[model samples]
Target: MTLAPAPKPAVAPPSPHPRRWAGLAVLSASLLLVVMDMTILNVALPAVSADLRPGAVELLWMVDVYSLVVSGLLVTVSALGDRWGRKRTLLTGFTIFGLASTAVLWAGSPGEVIAVRALLGVGGAMIMPSTLSMIRTLFTDARERATALGVWSAMASLGAALGPILGGLLLEHFSWHAAFLVNVPVMVVAIVAGLLLLPESRNPAPGRWDAFGTVLSIAGMVALVYSIKQFGKEGAAGPGPWIALAVAAVTLTWFVRRCLGRPDPLLEVRLFRSRPFTAGTLVAVTTSIAMAAVMLLMAQWMQLVQGHSPLETGMRLLPTALGALLMSPPAPWLAARFGTRPVLAGGLAVSGLGLGLLPAVPATYPWIALSLFLLGLGMGSLAIASVAIMAGTPPQKAGSAAAIEETSYELGGALGVAVLGSLAAVVYRGALPPAPAGGGLPGPAADAVRESLGGALEVARQAGAAGAELARQAKAAFTTSLEVTGLAGGLLMLAAALAVWWLVPRDLDVTASHH
Candidate 1:
């Protein structure tokens, strides 16, 4: 009996990293600022335009370049992080971000600003995936990982809620440069804290760096995003956008094939073969598509139509964050009770209901607040989606999973703004009553008015008392566009919900090790 050696006492699993929670704080705080950069820039753009007087093309580049650079570099950077230590990559990103922010002091021209933005994008690309991958490293237990992800998801909502308020406060006291400058101190702290708390992690067996694959990825991403932007600006009538799209299609296809053929690819394209990974990715993409256009429109409406100050608009947006905060922390618990499939699909349904309410309910602030709240509540399911993604992946592949998730968000947002934004523009133009025959506003002013809601408001300001009716009609038309866009987004959400229900396995257990 003694010879059996007591069956080796069923060795217990390893405990989680000692400093994981503290490390999570650093990662979440950094993520908060990264997300904040997007919304804060939106608030500061008017001030920047007034000071710099950038031409239309220059301004567009200023905005689009950051995302373009981020999208292009994400795959390569994420893979690099897997080979070169994730902690080292993240700390380097912080240094780059801090330095780039400091550069704003000397960035007097739009071109300089664009350069700074591109650099920040590089930093952001380095930072974003590393946070998720590190989370996967820090929390080995599946349930604990899910909780950490909830916190991670909630930080994004909090950052969005805070950006406008913070930006507004800064702008009132300082110049638009303050927005960029604000990143320096935060990045400094992140770098210091990350060095102390975050553990080094890498794929121990990561093979050859795919240099050609990197080129193909960067080219494909840039062309793809550029085509979407062009189509948004010029619609489907332009050959340039079509050419870009064709190039993107061919290059991306080649990239995918190359990845599949390699013993060690730049990205694990085969991750899509896993049901949970694909389902989780679909949720992320669809949620982003529904969220982006609506949030953009809402910000404009609150500021231009309702005449709210930037701070007020930011405060109004707080309900969405509040809803997310209330629901996100408990999402894993809910999933434990109901299972991942129901929780995820049900969340999408709830979000769809919220979006549908935008058109169905009265177009008042209170009703809008309610809709936003519901949207946030439903979006809490993203924590579970993330759990599914990371849990299903092998530990060595965490970087790839994180990159795919982040890329889904970026691409989905771009698609949302381009496709739904174009739809809104058409609706707005059609909804606007044409200027009275020949006796109405001058041709240039009329054209400006028809160009966008902002243009209409600006022209109205110049016209003074005579432009009241023009302003009124423009506001109404913009409202109509918002409602129509909301309806379309809601329908898309419902369709996604149905797809998720079918795709996610009913008996899937996120807590159990899958790989």
Candidate 2:
């Protein structure tokens, strides 16, 4: 047969993207800004409220609408990014974010500001998933991808920690509008850099867009988040929250069923079938719940109880970020040696121990620092969580994985604040001392003391010497509340650790291609 057909030439594996690291920098910076925007608004709200003079309902809407919109839009936007193109979607998101933030100057009313915040949410949803998916696209090597994700996770934690500090500094000198304005320059830089550095990526065979699935996702997510807010605020005081819950349950179930049935689902519901994906998601959700709630309570304790400034509170919280920063870069290497199973499970356990230590130690600044450092150290697991998730998922489904991970974060935060916050409120109310035998405080004032520590502090201030006892007791009760809540959070983290230990396979390899 003539020379036995020349030996087939070998085909080389595709080389990693040339500009991947540069692209990651742009992506990480953009992500930091978006995440920081979420918390910065919290610091700006009091000033905005003073100037806008919004009604109780209007203020609630202004605060809640941004997250509601973000939760509602993430699934739909992520699916669209997979079809349209991640780079184009991300750049467009930068434009929307810039324009929306700039529009804050003209937003005179509470409604206008709410609309502006909602627009920012839209941009956030677009930018968030695109960054993750693009990372997946750029880093073809598993080890490199894990390292990149470590950087990504570190940036996210840093952003959350930095938001309040930045907001406080801006508000110290500038108007509340400065909080919104700060985003503009960042967006401008992101858009220009993104265009130059980022590569276009899309699912090569992305199937038909799911219009009906989009509607279901939006309706389910909005209803679900709104229901959580209502229960947290009113606590079964009304039937409205229950009705929304019912709607959420039904629509979400329908959405999940639809996703599972469709070959080209709007969201990759089937990704949950992968054990590593499932374990990663569980870790993300559970850890977020504890971390978000604990951080929130600690911030309040610092400001209202310890009499620290907002900026001071933010700076104190830096230990958590510092811990994460110190540990994150080396997390992948640790996982490679120790195996992903121990790293993921041990991280949660260490975090739980941090919270557990909070209750055991004296509630002083130094003690809090020690606890926070350990907690941040535990947060380093987030990088491994990302590895497990993406490693288990196919390339085409990266957007879906990112969306699921993000949704877990958003939902977990809402749940933590709702559930754990309510628990703290109950403890605070219970721990408040009764009115003096002489009825040192009026009935309404006493009731207000029972309502919240901040309210009690105000009542204390106005009552002068009579209020001094009340203020001291209120602070003590709040400290007790934090301890109880911290314990509960610790327990939750421990439970999650136990679950993760069982869920993740013993021989799991982050570097392997699961798909």
Candidate 3:
């Protein structure tokens, strides 16, 4: 035995698998599908509305239900992925997405389409978490991980930009059904490729999946988002929204308390003890807040104000997406060279300056394009924000960290739409010169004109010269609102940059293992 032991020679342990890059491609495709679905409907809404003929409330639900479902389930599905397998969860999500997207072919009614979208949301919830968590596992090196996340962020930017373009093209040739159908082919490829290329990864010692925490998280997020949506549309006049907000507050607070008390929490709240994590979360929140509502308003401006077709609108928006596509991939390299604090803060400042210029852009088309390009360039720093998030989290908590970052984004967007939209509405309403006393507009039509620029345009078309004048008035008011919104958004970006600069540590290494 002693002789045998002496004869034993050292042998090297196996190296990490070499297929991570291929796995990333698969994950990026899935993420694109999820994100593209969110924006595809924007350009298709009119077509869908014409076909489905859903009522006002139903139309809103159709547009918003997907986001609500996606936001509500992100945390629950992420935890489930850890308890099960990340790759398994991702595949299951892809299956659900494919089947549901295919089911869209059968959807005839508004309710059915909403149901399909909700199901897609369920699939999205499952897919999103798995992608980020798997990336953390696939790329063990920090530099590699940062690059992977850059690609990940680029896909997201590309997806959001891609949706409207693809939808516009599809709607030009086919029915609204083509929008959902497009998801099926991409998903089928994703599913097959995923099974072959994506390796299985999960928490080696993931404790119990907290059922209560899941319920709390889902309910709280859903209620919060619903309330925000209601506020955006109807403001705080209703007790319903306020009550929902209260419930969200209570449930989320209790959920947080439970997380803190547990030895192994569903979400690792304590990880936020690190400066980088907190700063990253803040960046996610602020950037989303500054961008989401403005983009929505701009889209309306392009179509309702400028009278552009959906295809034209998509084309006009291309500069923003192109800028993001160009910037996000290189963001990691820039951060690696200059450090995250400067890049992230500088990006925010640049974004802010770009946004500030939005209010001053001449109404001409070329100026608008220039403003959008600069805005995209500024927002591209989002790639660095993602790096900050993963750098601060331990590998074991990748799913949790991803869930939190996503939650911030979702909620921030909701808040942005609700809060800033309300502001725009206020400005629009205020700027509306008392209906030209002699515009010959009906009392009901006059009320409609006051509601929104779109309403004004429709009323104007029917009211003759007076209607034309009213359309001009409404448009001018809308333009003012946009200018105000742009300035507000700019200020927010600048503030975020300053805050991020202060929040991130000077020497934080995002590429290093948190463990």
List the global CA lDDT of all models: 0.90, 0.90, 0.85
Query: Once superposed on the true structure, which residue ranges of model 2 sit more than 4 Å away at CA?
Result: 7-11, 436-440, 512-515
- The residue ranges of model 1 lying beyond 4 angstroms of the native Cα positions read 1-12, 436-439, 513-515
Error of 2 at 321 (Å): 0.3
TM-scores of all candidate predictions against the true structure: 0.97, 0.98, 0.95
Tens digits of per-residue lDDT, candidate 1, 1-515, equal 34654555665676789999999999999999999988899899889999999999999999899999999999999999999999999999889989999999999999999999999999999999999999999998888888999999999878888998899889989999999999999999999899888999999999999999999999999999999989989999979999999999999999999999999999999999989899899989988888889999999999999999998899898888888888888988888888999888988988888888988988899999999998999998767888888888887889999999999999988999999999999999999986622237888988888889999999888988877888898999999999999999989989998998999989986855432
Candidate that beats the other on TM-score, 2 or 3, i.e. the better one = 2
By the TM-score metric, which is better: model 1 or model 2?
2
Go through the candidates in order and give the clash count of each. 0, 0, 1
lDDT of 3 by residue, 1-515 (tens): 34544566666433445999999999998898788888888788899999989999889989889889989999888888887899999999999998998998889999998999899889988998899989877887778888899899889878888888888899999999888888888888998999899988888889877888989989999999999999989888989899999999999999999999998788888878888888888888987887888888988998888988877888888877777788888888888777888888888887777778877878777887887787788778678888898876767788999898888989889988988889999999999886453556678888888788888888888877657667778888998888898889889888888888898988765755433
Q: Lowest-scoring 10 consecutive residues by lDDT in candidate 3?
A: 8-17
Pairs with steric clashes in candidate 3: 142-511
Error of 2 at 68 (Å): 0.5
What C-alpha lDDT, on a 0 to 100 scale, does residue 440 get in candidate 2?
62
